[model samples]
Target: MSSSNSQKEILTLIRDVSTEKSQGERRVVNLKRQIEELQSELESVNAELEDAKRLKECTEQDLKGCEVELAMNESSIQTLEGRIALLQGEVSTIGSDLEALKVSEDICFVAGGFRFMCMLIKCLCFEIAWTCWFINLCEHAFRMKNGLCDDFIGKMFDLNAMIRKFHQSVDSASYEAFSSKAVLQNVHTENAHTKQVEEGKKDLERELAQIISDTEKMEHEFLLEQNLHKQVRSSP
Candidate 1:
């Protein structure tokens, strides 16, 4: 009986050992599966971290570029401001010159008009003289054929020479008138050019102001991005 009891106890021990070994095997397999899942998750997390690091580098590069652009804009804005000041000085100078030109133009206009009027009167006198000479010559020819007097021909030639001299004097006066008109036109052209230059300068100043505003805004955004990158880097 005792032998039988001992054999039964041994058998019970063997069965318990077998069950415990089976449970241990199952637990080990479950732990291995958990480890594989964890490993896969770790690999996924590492890939995401690498991508984030690359993104951070790109963002930093963009911030650096923004700073460079901001610096350049500041320099350009300063240059444009100086240029605007120069243009303003030029505009003031041109205004004074324009006033002087206006006075000169007015004076020249009256003188040119008088000279042209005199020239016209001289031309009329020449025309009248020519007509008289032609009529006198025709009459002299007829008188010669009819055997009459021809004493008026010499006098008519002398009168025509006097008219030619008067015409030449008037032509010389008209040259002065033409020169005055050309000078007045040149002054007007210069005034117009100066005004145009002033307008262009104003446009450039406005454009530079806009660029400055945009560059400052971009700089602000760059600072914000830098801060965000710092926060992200320190988060973990």
Candidate 2:
């Protein structure tokens, strides 16, 4: 009886040991599966971090490029502004010069017209003096031919005076005509200069307009780039 009891106790102890060993093996397998899952998650997180770092570097490069472009645009804007100011000043100067030219042209026209009128009057006076001299000479010749007893010496003196008067009238007429011509030429010169100044003003205006257009385009591009940079900075 004592031997049988001891064998039974030993068998019970062996069964308990076997059951504990099986439970321990199952727990170890579960822990190994958890470790593999955690390792996979760590590798995925590391890849995402590398991608984020590369993206940050690219974003920094883009920001630097944008800054450079913005600075260039600003410089261009300043240059255009200066050009616009210079053009405006030139236009104002041209306008003033044009006004002066117009006034001068008007004065020249008035003077030329007056000179032409004076020339016409002087020519008419010359014709009248010549007609009077011819009539007097013809009368004297008729009297002499018919022996009318006219004072021949006095008649000769009168004819000489008339001839001298006719010569003076002719001189005056020629001088008036010459003066009129010179004044007309001056008027033409002034008109041509005015036309040239106007053409220059127009060219300046066109250049100013083109510069303004270019500035507007650059400003728009700058705004777009600035907004893109802001978005990039705000991104996660």
Candidate 3:
């Protein structure tokens, strides 16, 4: 009975040892699987980190480019503003010059008109003198041919008076025409000069408008770029 009891105890010990060994092997296998899963996760995390690094580099490059573009836009805006100011000053100068030119033209026109009127009056006087001399000669010839009579003499005197009256009227009409023509020409020249000045002013306005439009466009682009830069800086 003592030997049987010892054998039974030995067998129970053996079975316990085998069961513990199996459990230990199962635990080792579980640890290996967990290690493999951890390795895969680590690899995935490393890949994600690489992608993030690349994204950061790209974002930095884009920010730098935006900064450069913004600077250029600012420079362009400044240049355009300067141009607008210069054009405005030039316009003012042009206006002053035009006013001075108009004054000079008016002075010149008055002087020229006076000289022309004097020349016309002198020509009329010369023509009247020639006509009077011709009429006197013809009257003398008629008296010599018809034997100087009172009736003929009276008729000749009446004719001489009528001729003198006609010549006076002609001289008055010619003086009026000369004055009117000079005034008309002066007005026409002034109007033409004004038209030219207006056209030049319009051209300057158009150029200024174009510059302003370009400046506005650049400002808008700069604002958008600035906003983008801010967003990039604030990004996580």
Candidate 4:
């Protein structure tokens, strides 16, 4: 009677141990499935993160290109402005020289007096030579004022056109810079970074860790029950 009771007790303990082991295995399987699901979600988030990074790179490139173009346009505009100033200075100098030549021509005519008359009467050839030389000087000064002055005006027109072109380029570059800034701002505003996704991933990781811990605890409990079953069977 005692042996039969002992055998019954051993059998009951073994059954209980097996049942717990089976339940623990099931829990482990479920935990593994949960982990796989979490990993899949993480992969999807990572893909989205990669796309956002690529878009940011492209926007940065565009912004840098626009900035370089703006710098070049600004430098060109400054150079044109300097050239215009130099040209204006040259024109002013030319005007002053023309004015002085005119004053000299007038003074030559004002030198008419009895002494001049006597000299002309005494030396007609000499007076004629002096008069012709003076006329030639006046004519040369007039040619320089007319011909070269027209050339300067033409150059000034060319400079003005260049200045206009520079201004147009600056305007275009400014527009491009503005457009690029808008694009960059939009990109940032869209918030295509990984902050939110990282939070989700962290949540999944914690859940997976908890599941694994619970599964391990279950396994430990199952092992303890198995040991208890063996001890019962070996009892005297």
RMSD of each: 17.6, 22.5, 20.7, 39.5
lDDT string for model 4 (1-236, tens) is 99999999999999999999999999999999999999999999999999999999998998787667656655655555565456555555645554553434222222222224444354556446656765775576567856576665675577557656655655554454335433443343334222323333454456555655555555555555555545544653
Error of 3 at 62 (Å): 1.5
| Whole-model Cα lDDT of every candidate shown, in order | 0.68, 0.67, 0.67, 0.57
lDDT of 2 by residue, 29-72 (tens): 99999999999999999999999999999999988987786677
Candidate 3 colliding pairs: none
Candidate 3 Cα errors over 4 Å, as ranges: 106-236
> Taking the tens digit of each residue's C-alpha lDDT, what string does model 3 give over 1-236?
99999999999999999999999999999999999999999999999999999999999998788778767766765665676566667656666655565544343344444545665686678678868876886777765755656666687688678768766866774565456445545575566445544554465566656656665665666566566656655765
Please report how far candidate 4 places residue 71 from its true position, in Å: 3.5
- Of the pair 2 and 4, which is ahead by TM-score? 2
What digit string (tens of lDDT, one per residue) describes model 1 on residues 57-125? 998998787667656655655565565556556555655554565445454455566657778986888
Higher-scoring candidate on TM-score, 3 or 4: 3
Who wins the lDDT comparison? Answer: 1
Clashing residue pairs, backbone N/CA/C < 3 A, model 4: none
Task: Return the TM-score for each candidate structure.
Answer: 0.48, 0.48, 0.48, 0.33
Q: How many collisions per candidate?
A: 0, 0, 0, 0
What is the model-wide C-alpha lDDT for candidate 1?
0.68
Descending-lDDT candidate ranking: 1, 3, 2, 4
